[model samples]
Target: MIRPKWTPVAWLADRMAVLVLGLIAGFLVGLSFAGDGRILPAATTVASTDGPAPSPVPPAPPVAAQGVDGPIPPQVTARMRRGGVLRVGVFGDSFGNGIWDALYRQLPTSDGYEVLKFAKEATGFTRYRTLDLEKRAYEQLARDPVDAVVISFGANDAQAVYDDGHLYPLMGDGWKRVIGQRVDRFVAAARSTGAVVYWVGLPVIRDPQLDADMQAMDGFYEAHMRRLGVPFVDSRPLTLGADGKYTAYLPDSKTGRPVLMRTGDGLHMIGIGYQRLTSGVAADLRRYAARVRQAAGRPAPTPTGEPR
Candidate 1:
């Protein structure tokens, strides 16, 4: 049909207008989803919330073993293997002091147990010199629970006089009695902590008479330790050579010759002496553990000479 030209143009314009509107609508819908080309679909977008995040699980607390009066029983081996720290408090004079630094260097860094040392120089058991030493030692024990304690105070106490009208050498008989009582108090202090206590008796000296005094002190210490069921490590024999004399600074066991075991004063041992003393003590500690196990009616753990 031959239609009017203006009518055809108007119809074409109307169709173009509808097409433009449809394109505009499509662009708006696309903008809503894509968000200015920086966003993904609205369905995939997430919004912030006001609630707390999920909490993380915490680790369980350490298990504390029950009180052990004497030795570690056999049944507790599994528990000990689970591994806890071993804090140590050393009470003694120069001799003990040497061992402390040596052990501090020798103890394995990767070992399961941890060792702590508290010491005072030239300190003794008796109140003759200072009660400060005793007070400090007690404070250390109270601060932490230790598995073992080592005592090396007799060297200073061999000539110790009590404040109770007793003196050393000059007061002879009464002096010994008072000194013994003071030692007892010292041992009692450590005993109350439930730690396996090891008393390192004084070593042999160059003077024969000093050796005699040390012997008497050793006897008294051993008796008290046995009475209290504590371990006594008599290092005098280890320090002496086969010649029955205080071995040279670092006496060679096989040759009976002096090695480098002392400082310039020829009285105190150097690092090597400390090494020997600690190794011996470490061995004895293992033995003590075994004895404790047996006493506790459990299978004794094997004794090791090396540090754990």
Candidate 2:
């Protein structure tokens, strides 16, 4: 066969390009598939702690006082008064990457709240059922009595399977039921520690189907948390783009551009991505912190204690 003069070079280049593309595609697939095959191990740390424990029941703070008008919300006011050591249990899989670390750095040095994390991406409620990392954290926090506990881990669970090994239905079905069960267990575990529960909703995903599943889970948890009187933070609105999907692979809020939320593999967020996410979370925490102060009638100080 007569070959063109550039055929050899072109063929080599083509092969190399295919090889690179294949590797990249494989990585993306791996990231999406990570933890899908393995059921998150059940959490087994539910053993109750001993001795006199602080009040686990988050009491309604005094109603905004008799006539004092504060910028803080009622919940914030209540939280401020009860403030002591805030032991936060950040729970989830890779979704939690940079979550705790970022929050740790952003926390106010003067807030006096001690934060603790119990997050591990790829692990879900199914894992918690047996392993119960949150329960362990609760017991740990109870040793010193943490004022609040923040739970964030829905990216994996939104499309995850239950203990029975059934994939949650495409719409609403056994999957929702199992997910609800998982959430219930998680809430109960965290609340049992007497720490006020703060559940974070799933943020938007790039994929449409995943985004829908995430919203469904978020809605279910939001309603459940409200009904149970637990505090729930919805992160979707903050992360969604004009198309109404997760826009940041790595986000640049200032420029409104997708910087790099996920790693090159698309499973984890890079440092910058985590930083941005934590910024949003920190803002929410600041808002909640203000609420705690107002509710508790405590004086407001800078969250970072030195001008944002």
Candidate 3:
């Protein structure tokens, strides 16, 4: 058999055919992988020590719910009545500022709510020597009577406490009792002024160890708040992913858009995160106020003044 003349034109034609076939094969392979739910590896940048590191993966969306339960006392209802000046005193560490600021901004203008901020950074129930929150609360209460009190501590409480020159490890036996006593005293002092108490729980932290510590602290708050009949607002479910781990970002509860919720430090919250948290708190407060009105045999007044 005589081979075809190996001319330049023929050689070029063969090469083009091979290239076309290779292209088709590559396209089909990519399509097959796509059908199998496979995707091209995304490019990631290595973080430098000079600046903050970015999140490795996008966080899952937050679940919808608030952490409020039980009935609102009649007295609390009366105090939180609509159209009255709802004197609210907020006390806690830096975390409290996020929620308090959001709450203050979102408070209903018609409700006539007055918020007094008393959040001191790096302060907690355990830091008695450094800052006595219980004493500060008492003094503030005595000076100005508040109708409701909002408290959010525990971020700074996950450390050793010094008592009589002896230091106790955080979450230890002695630490638990001392912190519990302080919390009890603070709650009692707020209640003495006929103010309803709302204790916000710590949210999930970015660091694994810190998240674990926060979870433990939340348990303490839950138990104590339950015993005292104060509303305990657990923020874990809101800030946690479906895997029950801490997430830096969560979807906007209203808009369904992804929003960076936590800060780079992983301990504090950004504005969007704080807004999401306080929105739930405000909603729960409104519900409690409505329940109070109902329990008092006074139906909620219609906005239009028409009988429902």
Per-candidate clashes come to: 4, 36, 0
- In order, candidate lDDTs are 0.52, 0.50, 0.63
Task: Give me the candidate number with maximum lDDT.
Answer: 3
The candidate, 2 or 3, that scores higher on TM-score is 3
RMSD of each: 37.0, 14.2, 21.2
Cα TM-score of candidate 3? 0.68
Worst 10 residues of 2 by lDDT: 33-42
TM per prediction: 0.60, 0.57, 0.68
- Per-residue lDDT of 146-235 in model 1, one digit per residue for the tens? 556777766555453544332334124445455555665666566456666666666666656546766787777676666555556666
Stretches off by above 4 angstroms in model 2 are 1-85, 128-130, 133-138, 158-172, 243-246, 249-258, 271-308
Per-residue CA lDDT of candidate 3, range 249-303, in tens?
6877767776677765666776667666666556665565555556555555443
Deviation in Å, model 2, residue 227 alpha carbon: 1.9
Which of 1 and 2 is the better model by lDDT? 1
